[model samples]
Target: MTASESMATDRPDDLPLPPGPNSYPVVGNTLGFLRDPFAFYDSLDDYGDVVSYSVAGEEFCTLLHPDYVEQVLVTEESKFGKSDFVQDAGERFVGNGLFASEGEFWRRQRTLIQPAFYRERIESYTEPMVEFAADAANSWIDGETVRIDEVMKRLTLRILSKALFDLDIRNQQSAIRDAVNAINEKGDAGSVDAFLPDWVPTATNRQFRRATDQFDDVIGTLIEKRRGDPPGDDFLSILLHATDERGEGMSDKTLRDEMATFLFAGHETTALALTYCWYLLATNPGVRGKLNDELDSVLDGDTPTMADLRDLKYTDKVVTEALRLYPPAYVVFRQTKEDVNVGGYRIPAGTSLTFPQFLIHTDDRWYDDPDEFRPERWTPEFENSLPDYAYFPFGGGPRHCIGMRFANAEIRIVLATIARRIEFDRVAGGDLDLRMGTTLEPTDPIEMTVVKR
Candidate 1:
């Protein structure tokens, strides 16, 4: 039956809720989910596509099917908004920037910020990305062990700072890195601190406050410096010069919020993607050989340029496959603005909906040997055969990640440039124990030995 027909036949009030595991009083499934989120979410697949669950007394319906993902993110998008918890949590961290704001405010902010990500503008970032990657790769001594995650984070942050703000932030890298880590730790879904009230006088709360303050200080100083100087061809300059039809531009506060959002979201997500890509390559010799062959043929020891991106086909697929296996933004949360029917289940208004890329991307129904790392499977024919949402490493729809293009370019350029200069061999860690934080993070640092190519 059609979705609308199903809804017509069974009003939300009359229909029974979707089947799911039973919940305990008060805490609901909070403890179980926190124990091991991957296993918990995977177990729900047996209950059906639309499974009802609760956490801390809040109701949620997880949509496992790609069709339902489309319904929430695309076609019926207006009927859903960012979930309440997300809005609240995001606002506390990044303020009412694009990631948190909604309605006309969000629309206006997006319109103002969109120009910075235009094709020509993003292409301009290629030089910094390649330069930073090459520098990082050259600095590594052969046979020296390094934390791959930290290396990627530092490299991506340098690229981001130069490309986005036209500033040298190496001096402040530690402060910014600490701040980001503190915030993520407090925001981790599995952490008890995540559920506590912000006003509470706990160590997590204190650390969170300190982190936000430190971040604000760093961003505030840079924005102030930019305002005093002549405009440059960077994102900060774009935001500073961006005026509305009424001839007004973003206020200092607004700029800080947006800057925080981009800096935090842009750098962190791409870093994780590159880190995971490296881990996968280290573990899979065949994939690494193929990637190296493509890099050798296309780049041949030269820094990658925007033009070379067209020929970096295998490199692109390797990144795509890595994202599929370990999407940084593991789960997206949305709330129903009105009662909605999905997968023959009637969901009431105000119910939270989860679109888990981590779970859906690995579902064997859409991907053969879904647990395996096979970049070769990303042929055009294979991609065309799957549902659109089945492979959305970046979330889909109008509200999809604004930096999707920027991040894609950065990941490819950095991966190609670094692979041309060096190779990584896993030293100790075999598999990642991922933590579902603001972004998917490895519970421990991913250590690898760098070998010059």
Candidate 2:
């Protein structure tokens, strides 16, 4: 149905939208929502805590209360399904892999894939993570203010590729990086604009198709390559040869989708998180100095080890707080599979849900001083006191990111590796902007003097 058609009707059950600003008919606030989602959300506070609005002509309700998130994410998995918008747009690349798959397929694949990201296996990737990061660091010339975000993207992409595949990758074979990156930049934005199909031969759609195809080819090759001679177990090798209890292997389409998801899930978000960490460090020197002290005390010229996660408390705090400020998956989109009560509102069946972690994390209600950049909020005792769903960088409930362990470990190693040698003093004068995408990224280039600390 056209957005105009969708918005024109007030469902018999429709309650006046949970109290937020009205948007234009059809288009709604979709363009504005896409422009600066955080601000678009924050501005909604003029009305109330929970707000309902439409975007891209689809009805959505935002849950600002963390308690509500706990209910949505943890207590009621059945009530919500990963939104169709995501399932549809994601299908273009990730296929019916766990991330895009719903119902039994999602359940089955998740169980099979869950073990690969366990503590033991993720720990094994630490050394490779440090090695790749250290090697990436060596090329860092003194007195240069490199774009740390770009550096981070390159770092995690390499880590996910080599560590997951053990240097033996699948269908994504060679073009993996570019293909995945292209999709990251273009695939899912405005996916629900029924008036505009992404497959149209428009230049933007052509670009998206080109990128998605490259990504698909790469994942396809990796699957086929590994299936031929499955040896030396890694995530891909295991998946390449994984079969259901009935002895049937996944369809080629399924494997390609999953491989793309892993590639996307494994790296891009981590890079953004690390990028935020650097920005936070650049802006707050006091926190930076303390972090350096932790690094120096923990390791005597050796790379950060997994065991360091316990002692490098401040480093852990930095990463955690950065996630609070700019979560990798900025928003968790869920749609009601069936209507149920939430935050005292009767969310009807088929209503799309917008649970913005960025908004929830920053809401003044839960945080003492939400605007300030303070890592101490993540102190051992303090962190434990918070509700399980209050701080959801990796999200919560069954769908919490599987790669959390690996990402945390890799980000820490990369953070410490870079922090130990380079001092990233903020560019000192520029208005920074956050470009909202599949992940949030700093639109401003941080030009800092990189001196050997």
Query: Which candidate number would show the highest lDDT if scored against the true structure?
Result: 1
TM-score of each: 0.97, 0.90
What is the clash tally of candidate 1?
0
Question: Per-residue lDDT tens digits of candidate 2, residues 118-222?
Answer: 888888888877887788678777887777777777778788888766772323344676666556556445333322456666665576678778766666676
Candidate 2: residue 91 Cα off by (Å): 2.0
Q: Against the unseen true structure, what C-alpha lDDT does each candidate score?
A: 0.87, 0.74
Best by TM-score: 1
Scored by Cα lDDT, where does model 1 land? 0.87
Per residue, candidate 1 scores C-alpha lDDT tens digits across 130-210 of 887888887889999999999999989998888778876766677677778777878899887776777888898898888
